[model samples]
Target: MSQSLDIAVIGATGTVGETLVQILEERDFPVANLHLLASSESAGQSVPFRGKNVRVREVDEFDFAKVQLAFFAAGPAVTLSFAPRATAAGCAVIDLSGALPVPQVVPEANPGILSGLGKPVQVGSPSASATALAVALAPLKGLLEIRQVSLTACLAMSSQGREAVSELARQTAELLNMRPLEPRVFDRQVAFNLLAQVGKPDAQGHVPLEKRLVNELRELLEAPLLKISVTCVQAPVFFGDSYSVSLQAAADVDLQAVNEALEAAAGIELVDADDYPTAVGDAVGQDVVYVGRVRHGVDDPAQLNLWLTTDNVRKGAALNAVQLAELLIKDPL
Candidate 1:
């Protein structure tokens, strides 16, 4: 807060990394200098920061001196290796990767959770589950206590990381070109197909990542007793994470008020026309979470159904990380 900030974007060539740069530019965040970091393969590549070209340096060569903040858009492996060094060198790290296991944060739901860090060495939720959960609960928090929530996520390829995004594009191209497919990033071909699993299978055959999503949302919402069930499926879309939520509230809630609440929610847009359910393509490059389809169970007034969408790489990953950083900068601990 005393001087212009020196910021480094680790993994500057990935999907979230590119969006992090764009968000910083679009929001005009104050920065004294910018550094782009990636693996050795992209060491000499250059990415535009503000108006100048910042060459992508290898993570091993990142100089943390004078850097006020470092956005870790890489992965857990990189964060485990570099984040501590950056913090030790006096740089605050805002990681987009799901490296920070504790203190899970969804800005709208848990802004106060990141309090008292003069230099927050790490921040960010791994996937869109927390982001989508926050948007869906915004209306219910005021109307009725969210006793329980059941959600199933249609995760986009981009959420898996840059490699998966590339796989989606490459596989799609091969399909269009009528070429034989050999999947690399994903366990199977993503084009013209869906994977009912994400991350890896656990004892019950449910993906661990999806279970973590439910756990992360519970922690962020501070509803320890909140009943949450999730089934994550990998969709072919390149961006956007969608969730179908069925919630049971404390009492009979007003549907109109819920709709209006969603409409007025900060950092969220309600798409409520007859044909206005937000689409995956619609969320690409957008910042806000989109919510729609409000319905009440006929026999149970406390039960509700809704759909939510968000740009996984933006709102779900980069933009949300930036939003947390902005909040920290405004009311520094």
Candidate 2:
């Protein structure tokens, strides 16, 4: 007998939300009913779900009493206002915001951690860390205790949000048409530029998103003391994320064995130089993590350097949320 579950996607019109819908349809999740919720401005609009149209509802009017699972992607504000109510109503909330203060999930990188949560696990981590976690951890699984990691991410405009995606498209059209460029949704022109930050500034100038990555990565890896240094930059690319990870681990780690482990791991792909080696765009729409340029650290042979990429929207955010939902369905609470 097939199980029936009512699935609700909050923020269904946003970038991650839209991508989640596409993935859910592509993967054919066992959704008995699909509910799309967004702000009032987007409410009443229709979105495709399982080949049929599902009308978007206003978040304020959403009823969670009969919802078996709710996928919250709107933001922390909405999640805080509604998540508890949904949970109290017997709905398991899978939040995409950092608000719930729980699992910072990268499903391919870490699965089963969301299990036994008794309710939803909020996903934190920036797009950078999500990609890094998926690729970097593949090689070291169970073999090396990663003590410290330093990562610099080359991110896409999509990380900023859907409005940024639109801004990029509008600016690109203007550029190709030889029109003057104006910027919004980004600090400056993003069509032919790179920005070093995302989200608001902290006292040290680190964005909230970047700080979340450090803490979330530590929690996800179960290495609470794991030291992480990160610098996130937004590139002109449309999708995907790329990173260079330098890790300090135990003594005399075998690069060959690490590479072998990554090559054989599920949901990961090893890219060779002859394959035209690396690019952020290469990760778009791909479900697997891509690893390249694996080498020993210059300072210490125990340390390792790796280049990683994944579809920022796929494995990084949307697909990861969907993967968690899938896991829940396959194995109930």
Candidate 3:
């Protein structure tokens, strides 16, 4: 922990990348030199670090050998293209984008996975929804024999990036002023309407996000054969992703134990039944997942239902990757 290491943040100009920089400063990661990298278009932009605005350089031109650790917080294309070069240069990589088929890690759920990784370590952070779900459910895993999980993830526009967030705002303003609305970032009007699917469905009628949830959640929970049914709905919100989850347990449900488990778990804030949580009210700009509305299904003691929310950009993507780095540096990176 005393040794300082050079680190690089890919896609530093983007939302998740910027948040990663902020969290690294906030958590005081043992960093030596901090390199901020972006695409050609985003290069020359500056991201505020500890006490200075660090000018971001183009990722393609930067040498990966300069840093001991690198965080790939950009899109899949960026991670897919540059991560191998980083690993080839002996730099440890923690990717937030789903490009790499490496291990999907949530520190709270599977911190032990890092120790078993191979040399020139490579790991992936789960999607925002899966990260929140793993934080909520991992604690209860030992107490309940979960058979399957059903979830409807209400994603905010920010999950799609800054443009989606702006489009939501513009569409809302035009609607309020009774002006003609033209959808640009989204295929249709997302303001005051729920999008049934996030992207085009494959032959099996499941979108990519849904597949990501299933695969990543299973990995995080260490349940390779676990059954999961998820529907990623685009909610007309600006930030935070919410989930309506139902877990089918093998035995009769225990409400008190479930509540206590959530209450004592790390990276989770359990709300009382008196009032439920909303994305804007509870989760936005926060670091932990907010869980409420915990109860058993009507006339079905084996079914447990809950509501969860978290900041998709911060806690879900950036912070999760940063946390993996913290654990990875525990020994040597």
Candidate 4:
């Protein structure tokens, strides 16, 4: 049997944080004690875990030295403020907020990066879109050297957090009732409409989400020279993320071999050509990336296309954080 350790989950009331707590129990991670910490506004709330209620304590009041591992699912500001403190207190941290200036880890793609780390170091989890993209491209890395990658990611409002989810629900209802649309969580209407940009545009015109996907993919693939371009769109749905990827390989590739490679890849479920996965219909609550609609360019056999989807909250954020923690525990690096 695995030995139990003390664990603390920051931002216990947020969407990803809540999911992390649930996954810890679902995956049967050995735990001697579980601590839930949140901001003062959310503190005192009870979160269910292992058939009991665990009250959340204010993060400012919690002592990081008490826990062996800390999972930060809070936003960037919160993570930045507390992660360093936790690390200094000798607590290993797996940050899902993408704010930590640490090694960004996707366990399935680069578990080795964590093996050499010192104890109590902070590890950043890649963005949801980046995580899905990295997992999809991992199998194709050596099979056919990729020259460039272009992708369009359709993200749901849930990726923004629980408030965004609630805003989407509110806007959707108002629209159905023929009321004026109120856009708060998002810059524009997200009810039965799609936003071309997911975040504020940069000087070069690329949104923050798009920039993150490109940068993180290159990092996770360990291919600094690899060229990647991405467009992030906010879909009207409430959960899951979908991607349409176009890969330009350096050499001719066989369709059969590509399909076989994806089939054998970890944390991926390749669907049949005749069937495809939708975020709402197939990806929600699932733990693996669902891939289908694979086809090679007719004019250029070196080019390939694919459609991928996964639960943004599950495999994208919460599960990946938990898996990273598991890896750190097993290796204690």
The top-ranked prediction according to TM-score is 3
The TM-scores of all predictions, comma-separated, are 0.92, 0.91, 0.99, 0.97
**Would you list the rank order by lDDT, best first?**
3, 4, 1, 2
Query: What tens digits encode model 3's per-residue C-alpha lDDT throughout 1-333?
Result: 648999999989888999999999999998899999988999999999999999999999989999999999889999999999999999999998999989999999998999999989999998998899999999999999999999999999999999999999999999999999989999999999999899999999999999999999999999999999999999999999999999999999899999999999999999989989899999988999999999999999999999998999998999999889888888777
Model 4 TM-score is 0.97
> After superposition, which runs of candidate 4 have C-alpha atoms over 4 Å from their true positions?
none
Q: What's model 1's overall lDDT?
A: 0.79
**Which prediction has more favorable lDDT, 1 or 3?**
3
Maximum-lDDT candidate: 3
C-alpha RMSD for every candidate: 2.2, 2.4, 0.8, 1.3
Model 2: ten consecutive residues of lowest lDDT: 119-128
lDDT of 1 by residue, 1-333 (tens): 444687888989888898889899999887778888998987898888778887888989777885878888887898889988888887777766677654667677778777844554466655666776775685467677887888888888888877888889999999999999999987788888998887768888778777778777877777877888888889998778888889988898788888888877787877855745554556667878877777887789999888888888888888887887787676542
Per-residue alpha-carbon lDDT of model 2 for 305-330, expressed as tens digits?
88888777777888778877777676
Better of 1 and 2 by lDDT: 1
Which regions of candidate 3 deviate over 4 angstroms?
A: none
Give a tens-digit lDDT track for model 4, residues 240-264.
9999999999888788998999999
Q: Which runs in model 2 stand beyond 4 Å of their true positions?
A: 119-128, 173-179, 273-281
